[model samples]
Target: MPHDIISGDRHPEALPLAEKVREEERARIARDLHDELGAHLTGIKMALGLLRESLARAQGPEQPLEQARYAEQLIDEAGDAMHGIIDDLCPPIVEFGLAEALQWQSRMFTRQTGIVCRQRCGDGLDELGEFEVITLFRIVREALSNVAKYAHAENALITVERQGDVLTLRIEDDGRGFDLASAARNGSGLGNMRRRAQALQGTLQLDTVQGKGTTITVVAPVAR
Candidate 1:
C-alpha cells in the first residue's frame, strides 16, 4: 500500500519545488506576453491602421480593391500571429483543460489557415497530469506549426488515446511531404518536436513520403 501510494505520487520528491517552478515559469510567460508579444502585435495593428487610413483616403476602384485586399491580409496575418504568440506563451490548454482548449485551437487554426483540423481524444485523457497535458500540448503545437508552415495541408487529424500505462497522440496531415534526411540535416521543426517529446520521457516519430503527407506520433507513460 505504501509503495502503491509512492508510485502514484509523481512529484513526491519535489512537489513544493515543482509547484514553485510552475509559478515562476507562468510569470515568465506572462511577462513575455506583456512585453514582447504585445508590443509587436500592437505595432502591427498600428501599421495596419495607418495603411487602412491611406487606403480609405485613396480614390480608385481597381487599386483600392487591391489595397484593401492587401490590408485585409495584413490584418489577418497580424491577428493570427498575435493569437499564436499568446497560445504559445500560455497554452490555452493550461486553464481550460485538454478538450476545450484543443477544440478552440483547432477552430482557430482552421479559421486562420483555411486548413481543416479534426481532433479526437479518449476519455482517459482527462486523467492525465498537468505535465502530461503540457507535453501533449507542445506536441500538438509543433505539429500544427509544421502544418501551417510546411504541410500545405487542406486537412489534418489529431487523436489522443490511452492504452494501459501508455498514452499516445497522433497528428496526421495530407500535404506535400519531404525527405526526412534532408529535413533533419537542415534541422526542421520535427527535431524540435522530438526534443519536446524526449523532455517528457516520450518519443515522437515522423512518418512521411514525398508528395504524400505526414503523420507525427508521440507516446509517453501515463502517470498513475
Candidate 2:
C-alpha cells in the first residue's frame, strides 16, 4: 500500500501549477473548437442555406442532384464536427478508467490508422488524486497524438504502473524517432505534455532513437 496526500497538504506550488495546466489546456481546446468544429459548422450552415434556396426555387421534392450531394456533404461535415468536439473534450476520461480509456483509444486508433497498439496498466492508479489523474492523462494523450501525427510507426505500446512511491506512465512507439535534444524546436505537442507533467511536479522522460522508436515516460510522486 502507498500513502496518500490530500489537497491541503500537497506541495504548495502544485495548486498554482495545476491551475496553469487547466488554463492552458482549456485555451487549447477552445482554439481547436473555434478552428476545426467551428469551420465544419460554418460549412454545414452554408450548405443548408443553398439547400433552402434551391427548395424556394421549386426544385421538386426529390431535390436536385447537387443539393442532395451537398446535403450528404453537410452530414459528413456535421459528423466530423461532432467528433472533433468530442475529442477536444477528451472522450477517454469518461468512457473508462484512465488506463482502460487509453487502451480503448489505442484499439480504435489501430483500426483507423493501421498501427498496432498495445497497452498494459497495473493496479492502484484508479485511486490516484484527481489532479494527478488529470495531469497524467493529458501528458499521455498529447504524446499519443504526436505519435499518430508524426511518428511513422507500425506499432506502439503504452504501459502504466506504480513503482514504490512513484506512479509511471509510458508511451512507446516503434517508429522513426527523432532527436530528443531537438524537441525544443519541434511542435507544441511534446511541450504541452511537459507542461502538463510539470504542473503536477512530475518528471517527463522523452527517449528517442532515430530509425528505432520513441518512448515518453512520466513519473509523479504517488505519495504526494
Candidate 3:
C-alpha cells in the first residue's frame, strides 16, 4: 500500500518558484494600475479640464470655479500616487540598467526624504540578469527606507561593485545606529532584505554602531 507522509525537508526548487510567482504577481498588479486605474484617472482629469473651461466661459460664481480647481488638484494628486505605486512594484529595468536604476533611486530618495543620498556603481553591472537586478534594487530600497525612517541619517551612500564572480552591494548611512539583536527581533524590514539576498543565493551582513553609523552589505554570486 502506498502512503503519504510529511517530511521536515524543504524542496530545493521552492525558493526560486516562490520568487517567480511573486514577480509575476507584482508585474500583473503594476500593469493593472498602469492600464485600468491610470485610464480612469486620466478620464477624470480630462473631464475636469472641460468643466473648468465651461465654468470660465459661463463666468459663473467664483465659488464654483474654485471648487472645480480644487477637484482637479485632488485628481492630479491621486494620479501621482498611483504612478508611484506602479513604479515601486515594477521598476523600469528595461529603460534603465541596474546602475542607472540605482542612481535614479538615490536621487528620488533624497528628493522625497530630504536626506542626502548618493550611489557609486562599478562597471559590468549592466550585464546582470533581470532577476539579479530587481533583487538588488529591492534590497537597496528597503535599506534606504530603514535609513529614512529610523536612522536619522544626514547622509547615505549606496555602492555596488563586482569582485570576481561575486557582486557586493552596500548601503551605508551616517546616523544613529540601533542594536542589531533588538532590530532582528523587532524589525520585519531586515528580515525581508535578508530573504531577498537569500533568494539570490547570497549573504547579507549588517554592521552598526550606536551613535555612529550603519552599513548593510549583500554579497551574491553573479549569475553566469
Candidate 4:
C-alpha cells in the first residue's frame, strides 16, 4: 500500500508506512473481534442450542419450529464466519509460539500446494518479543505466498536461527526465477517484504537468477 509499491519505486531503505499502519489496524481489530465479537458469537450459538432443546421438550408448534430452525442455521453460519475472521486477524501463531507456528505453517503450505516446504528453526525463537514474533511470522507468510503464486517450484525451504543479537530468516525456492527489474516493476510483494524487513531495523537480501531460483534473507535484532 505504499506509494513506492504503487509507483514502482525500488529504494531498499524506504519504509512502507501505509502497510505498517494497516498491519497495526489489523492487530487492533483482531483483538477486538476475538475478545468482543467472538464472545458474543459463542454466546449466541449456545443460546440457540438451548432454545432448540427447549422447543424440542415443549413440543413447539410447527411455525415456531421452522423459525427456530432457520435462526439456528443462521447462527451456525455466522459462527463459522466469525471464526475465520478471528483466525485471519490473529492466527493460531502466538498461542503455539513462533517455531511451532512456522512448522505448522510449512506443513500446511506443503499440504495445500503440494510443494514440499522444509523448515529448520533453531531454539530460543519463542523468547522474542511479540512485535518480533509477528513480524517474522508475516515475513515468512508473505514469502511462502509469493512462492505459491510465482515460484512454480517443486520444493522450498525456510530457515530461522539466532546469532548473537541478530535473528535471521531465510526463504529459498528452486523455482523459475524472474528478472529482478521486472519483479521490481510489479512493486507489490517484493516492496512489502523489503519494507517489513527495514521496519525492524533489519536488512533484507534477495538473490535470484533466471532459470535457477530465489532466496530471500532477512536479519533483524532480537528485541529484548
lDDT of each: 0.72, 0.71, 0.84, 0.80
Model 4 residue runs over 4 Å out of place are 1-25, 43-71
| TM-score, prediction 3 | 0.84
Model 1 shows how many backbone clashes? Answer: 0
- Residue-pair clashes per candidate, as listed? 0, 0, 0, 0
Please tell me which predicted candidate would have the highest TM-score against the true structure: 3
Candidate 1 clashes between residue pairs 3 or more apart in a chain or in different chains: none
* Better TM-score candidate (1, 3): 3
lDDT of 4: 0.80
Q: Give the alpha carbon lDDT tens digit for every residue of 59-119 in model 4.
A: 8687776777788899778878877887777676766777888999999999999999999
- What is the lDDT for 7 in model 1? 15
Model 3 over residues 1-224: C-alpha lDDT tens digits?
11112121144335555776797799899999999999999999999999999999999799888899999999999999998899888987534778998988999899999999999999779778887888899989999999999999999999999977899999999999887656666767887777777778777788888888888888989965
For model 1, residues 1-224, the per-residue Cα lDDT tens digits are: 00100011234444435544664597577677767877876777677677667766775566765766686687678767766766666675666667666777788889988999999987776777766676577668778988889989899998888898898889999999777656765644666566556656666777887788888888877777
TM-scores of the models, in the given order? 0.65, 0.68, 0.84, 0.76
The C-alpha stretches of model 3 lying farther than 4 A from their native spots are 1-13, 111-115
Model 4 residue 211 lDDT? 80
Scored by lDDT, model 3 comes in at 0.84
